[model samples]
Target: MHDDEEMLRRLRVDDLPPSMVDLNRAMRAGRRRERMGAVVAGGLAAVLALGTVVVVAATTGKNTAAPWPGAGPEGSRSPEPAPPLGNCTIDEAPVASQSRMIKIVANRSGQVFVMQDPLKSGNLLRWMDGRQERIDGVPTGDGYGTAAAVNGSGAFVGASGYKPAWVYRDGTFTVLPLPPDVSAMSMVGINERGDLIGTAFYWDGRDDTRAVLWPASQQGTPVLLATPAGWSSEAMDIADDGTVVGYLSHRTDNGPVDITPMAWGLDGSARRLPVPAGWTPARAGKRGPYPIAIAGDWVVGAGARWNLRTGTAEVVEGLMPMKVDKYGRLFGNVPLSVPDNGSTSGRPAVWVNGDVQPLPIYPDRPEGTLFSVSLDGRRITGTSYVTSGAFGTATWTCGR
Candidate 1:
């Protein structure tokens, strides 16, 4: 694996809380499905070459790759059907050439914002009504441009270099002026009203980081969100209503770190979310419950969902809700444990009212992961790993 890819894998695996119970059952079912999937893997190279299927492969294979055990032609077991999304339909998005990987950063009202090549040479792309357009003119120093969030108005927030956060709107990239000392000022989330939130690092001797918010106009000075005493914080996401979600961690004398999930309001007020019941301490390689996405009345973290209205949090077994759409449908990955190696993998999954359903992967694809889901859950976007060893972006829409 490439150095960056290896680092990412380590981060993701390390982020998962320790293995839970019933993993054996889940693994058994997954292995059976994997076996079924392995049977038709060989024929997919042809389908991938045609590029006619919605879940298209990134490259054409040489037919030398070995299929899984019990291999056969396509339709050998009838591929798994897509999960139903009531009153919502999915439309596949076009894959851009040379786009090795994709991350659908945001979607609203059928308009999708995707960040192509999330790790290297990033480009901001938008999809709607069967047309895809790449927004040009994002600045870069030595590193590439990457977007973290988009608002309903089509304005996106990100950072170009260590010093300047940027807002891309209507084919223009505007610098978000900050103090000269601020570094690593990446915008993480934005709301429909064009309000944005992100973290800015101060390169003081301690290397502290704090959250900041920018208003829609981009005229006034950025507002710095509160950080607790002796704790450094990073704001990860923001809801349309201006609620910010992130984590708080303390480092004493550069020792072991402890993180606490946090939420901030429009007024810049901060509160620590109580750890859900039955929550266990993350093992040395695991991360504790940390909030990742915030939608109306809900905050999704590492292993649980917090209901802001009721002040109640529930544990989601085997799934960590990553993005919660407007209609409350949850999109994330299910961690799969391999009985042989004691290692784990993530399967793209969706949840409604605590019921989980794994998303379908193509016969030729080794794995898949979701990045964004539309408000009504009709559109889901993610990436699939093809047998040719390349990653391709995929969009799943509810169809008749």
Candidate 2:
């Protein structure tokens, strides 16, 4: 690897921590914008049926092609009016105060979910129809609660208090059942089918955990995914088709955490996908470069996609993927940085047909991170940090 690439890889790997607490806090530094406590898979777009708002044609019963008073021909029509100039701007108010950090931003269909004061506020805010509503009375669990994932039906899953995992559906909270020997669990991703995937950890002072899958109907037996001996696994993202992706971390004889990529089938069968050639463990874990969004033919990571059938990999030259829309387009910020309050800021960019285009920045909010994009790729949400060091949850829309 080139010295620069190697250095970048080292830096990314070093930022990865196995603990969910530290990882959640670090998200403010431009990490994966998944649900509160889980890794991003962008599966809600598929399960939730989030269709974009379309501009319907304005039709009158009568034909209006007739030329006006000074016009030339009777059949003449003004050059078909140019397409509408879409509206794109940031939200007017910050989702939270400057003392709190907006960690998780997710969307289902057209509704936006923002976890304000993550791990501290436990406040889950939803935005729809230009208004914001907080799901009333969610357990914040000593202010350490974090949202893990949200499904299409607006159902939310996350870890709270001593149980470490819970689900909120229809305005009620249900504690997820844990294994006989497991004391702690971290719920991460939930598929449209309502199947939950996460990690089950024990309180026995061992760093061992197993990837687990729970059915939505709460009917079938919970599936505990098998991991290689001496390795601990955490289930991160789940696709609509029941595919699960996450990482495996194990200790070396001398002492260092080594990580690898893992995937599982709906039947609980497990397999390890090869990390892209020359990509080190750190360049491809927790935050990505590992498959987070899976569809019929593609498994996508931060800046790369692998074809399931041909097993070929295509890399986007210079984009770090944060989330993928239903169309398989990657959303993330570019490596380019701008100065903001004595620190560098990144420009949000999207990859379409492998070409990079930076998203428009609102004049009021000079620098922001783009985390969650609507399934249609029309709406996006993230935290915009102002020059004054104050940040708030923000959303942008095009073609609205």
Candidate 3:
């Protein structure tokens, strides 16, 4: 096995927090899927050149890639017109093509941002009004640098290896302060109010990971979110209204277990998000459904949406939801297939009222994945796999 794959395997089997485990899994899965897609596409092209009719037998059982209770087939049909948001159109976004891997991280207002080669030392690119700029001077070294979340104002936050969490605004990098005695930290999301949220921990021979926040007014000191004893928390995303969403997990003799979705109010009070019926941490192996984004009263993650106000959870099934728009539309990807090994090949799609709408892909690039969606659900950004087996950044715009 390659070094990176081995490292990811160790991380999942060992003591990393649930959120970190999820991240590693996502990275590994993406790499594997892309490679596999390229091979399959190449082989199909060779077969077609010879005009051979290929008949592959189907192995039937419980398809792990089966759509959620009501979802349609992957790429089964064109997306239905989204009311109010209107019909959608797609266009290729400008990106540095030098990187082998590209990831669209966030879309806010009219600005769309991407990370080129995010798993390694990477570059941050931003686009607005037909102009693209590669933001320079982000910290890098032994660890990867990434911009996890961005707000409407274009200010972004993220972390690098062993470095304190930092925010970038107006071409300046502001390293966020850590609490006393904390050894390392990383920021994941920044709100319109400049409140930043992420995970912080120590390397002092203790398994301590906690969700922390740095208010816009006081960038020097971070406030640690409350967690029950024996529990560790990792903040994933913060809504503009100052609500933070993430997960809580505790380490057991075997590993981390009992991951529970959680949300924190603007006043710094933490509340547990409702879990879907029949959901169990063991089903996913030491991890529970965790919220990846919060818009208004909706907390979305793990193919489920939880209403903070109604205290109800709805499972969207088959979707690996990434972001939720204010209209309650969920934007993410669904698995095209799940191999016996459990890895999935995903196609970019959106779920409206429980119906999966496959996004339009470039005529030449058949594979893609969805990432960030604008609050209005009009503009979305992700990666498009080209014929050569490489992928590039892409964006889609929808309107009435």
User: Pick by lDDT: which candidate is best?
Assistant: 3
Q: Cα lDDT for residue 29, model 2?
A: 18
Model 3 lDDT on a 0 to 1 scale: 0.60
In angstroms, the error of model 2 at 185 is 2.9
TM-score of each: 0.70, 0.66, 0.73
lDDT of 1 at 70: 24
Cα displacement (Å) at residue 78, model 3: 29
- Candidate 3, run of 10 with poorest lDDT: 41-50
User: What TM-score does prediction 3 earn?
Assistant: 0.73
Q: Which segments of candidate 3 are over 4 A away from where they belong?
A: 1-86, 94-99, 114-124, 139-144, 253-256, 281-286, 339-341, 386-388
User: What tens-digit string does per-residue lDDT give for candidate 2 at 264-315?
Assistant: 7775455444444434333323333446665443456644555433334454
Instruction: Estimate every model's Cα lDDT from 0 to 1.
Output: 0.56, 0.53, 0.60
- In terms of lDDT, the poorest run of 10 residues in model 1 is 45-54
Which of the two candidates, 1 or 3, achieves a greater lDDT against the reference?
A: 3
- For residues 1-400, what per-residue lDDT tens digits would candidate 1 score against the true structure? 4321221231221332222222233442342233212122111110001111111111112111111112244231112232455433233446452334334565554355556543335566665446667777777743456676776667777665453568877768887767447746756777778887877776566456777888666535887776655666778788776778887665445344566666777754555554555555541124555788876656777666665543445555555556776545578766543435444445567776656667766655545556666665667776666435475556677533
Write out the backbone clash pairs for model 1: 89-398, 90-397, 90-398, 91-397
What is the Cα-based lDDT of residue 253 in candidate 1?
A: 50
